[model samples]
Target: MSIISLRSILDANKLSGNNFNDWYQNLRSVLMHEKLIDVIDKPANVAPQKGESNASALDAYAKYFEQSTTTKCIILASMSPELHRQNESMTPAHIIAHVKKMYESESRTSIHRISKSSFKIRI
Candidate 1:
């Protein structure tokens, strides 16, 4: 286990739409620690088909399924109720993409505006 408590490591702060950058970084840290970041990035293929006989294939799909489910729970628990409701049906990967689309560009534009304004501040 990490020296840091899981609570601290996971940054219990929920994503309320105003803290996307911080929330994103925190999530990345947690996923990386769990070694499940790929579940949200690559999104492995669907579960093995019924009647599948290959033991390795079954094990691979099982691993992906377990990891994906854990990632989804983490993402959901870190979201505000409204955000969770909107994304609860989505897979972990889809939820991340949706959040990025909603906030990543917005944050960049906001930062640009802030920088421009700060450069002109009298104090």
Candidate 2:
């Protein structure tokens, strides 16, 4: 019901600028989509109850993260890069590769895999 910037959300959580914003933005999109689903499911109803509890947009976001083990892990992984380093020889390429693997392995396929030529970190 409210439009909050990704920055505000991250700031509230005491999270610095990182991939969390991107992830949260995508998650917000997902939350908006579920809101659309709620409107479709209940035409006259504003607040829909999920069984015994009234489900809000935040609840949906929380439920999604709670029930989905892979998504939870992915979120944590994005926040903590140190978890990916198993060996001292790990290069940026290796880190990116591991992230790619995790993204591919997840149930969600939203992460884009761009060709090297298409992506340049520094312009």
Candidate 3:
């Protein structure tokens, strides 16, 4: 089945909504339970940005965004620790604006990097 179809089934069955990470986790669980796919984690070798500690919630959400880049970056930024850091200037609104800007002006070379990766996304 298609990704949208699978996602629809989950939503229709009340398995998920408004929580993409949880939705994907549950979807993968179902796919594995049905013996339809193998388990894989962090299939991409791309590393987190330098100085972005993995334990930081911002890093965690960024990683999630990297895995699911099709999702809005604002949504990812909404879940970032940077939004909550007392010293940070990154308001959710700021993040939203930056996300929109990045989305609209993203370079082709960045897109090429993703396409060149060998990770498989099985339905």
Candidate 4:
């Protein structure tokens, strides 16, 4: 797919800290639809050890790494400036994990509060 197309989509759905789940879902859906999920889902396979013929694996790794980094950059471009600053040095996987941690904690805390309120009402 063209970079222009991807950029346009990201521009329209740009993320700015809040609404992370929605932003992530839309971004992921677009990426998957473009058949570029492997770039984010799979890391480059390890190189072969000494004395082993690793030509094919090396080639695959190189291609995967290139695409992965490109995809990571694209995804980063859609994030908020603060999020980008915090995660600029991170790999795509690490960035994703960080975002999930931030948002999922909010969800968990909400659930806990709701449960506590229910218990209080019963008691």
Candidate 5:
């Protein structure tokens, strides 16, 4: 995607801490579109060790690093500043897992709103 389009996508779904479900779904869509979502499932040690010169291993590391960095940037850019600060040091996979663990449950206010709306029926 063009930079403009990517910026647009991130802006639309920018995570505000409580909107985890919507933000994560949008992130997945963007990553899938860029074919980078699989990076989140790979171990962070996919990086090659120094002087470990197997051609295939090096190639794998190169691809892994590219996908990891790109996906990481996308994930970070879509986050709130607070979340970005908290997760800045983690790998893409770890960041996703951390945030998912932290925010997967809808906030009480959100759940209450949904419940309230769902029951607002009139005869």
Candidate 6:
């Protein structure tokens, strides 16, 4: 997808201190649609040195790095200026973790509000 179009999506979903869950879900959906979900899910294991029994890990890491950088670009393209500033230096994995923390905290607050309101209803 074009970076300009992706930036438009980010602009529309700008995070203004709330609505983290919706923003994150939309961002993730976009990333998935771009076929970058592997960057969020699978990280390459450390490569063994030459002469080690399991040198194949090196190849895996190479592949992972290639895909991960592409994924990072997609994510960066879809971030608002504020969110991008917060995570500009982070790796793709760390960016996802940071977003999850921000959004999950808000989700808990929403759940609490729902439960509190539910208890106030009379049968």
Q: Give the number of the best model, judged by TM-score.
A: 1
Candidate 6 lDDT by residue in tens digits, 57-113: 767777777877887776766667787788888888898898878778878798899
The residue pairs found clashing in candidate 4 are none
* TM-scores, each model vs. reference: 0.88, 0.23, 0.21, 0.72, 0.80, 0.64
Tens-place lDDT per residue, model 2, 1-123, is: 996543333234421233444544554454344343232122222234455464466576565434343323333444444543442244323433454465444424323333333466544
lDDT of 5 by residue, 3-51 (tens): 4354467787789878888788788888887788788865664567888
| Each candidate's clash count | 0, 0, 0, 0, 0, 0
Kindly report which residue stretches of model 5 are placed more than 4 angstroms away from their true locations once superposed: 1-7, 107-109, 120-123
Compare candidates 4 and 6 on lDDT and give the better one. 4
Model 5 residue 14 CA deviation in Å:
0.7
In terms of TM-score, which candidate is stronger, 4 or 6?
A: 4
- Candidate 2: residue 112 lDDT (0-100): 39
Q: At residue 28, give the lDDT of candidate 1.
A: 88
Give the lDDT ranking, best first. Answer: 1, 5, 4, 6, 3, 2
Judged by lDDT against the true structure, how good is candidate 1? 0.85
Worst 10 residues of 3 by lDDT: 36-45
Q: Count residue pairs with overlapping backbones in model 3.
A: 0
What are the per-residue Cα lDDT tens digits for candidate 4 across 1-123?
635355567777777755676778877877787677766677645656777777897777777778678777877888878888888898777888888888767766777899999999999
What TM-score does model 5 achieve against the real structure?
Answer: 0.80
Model 4: what TM-score?
0.72
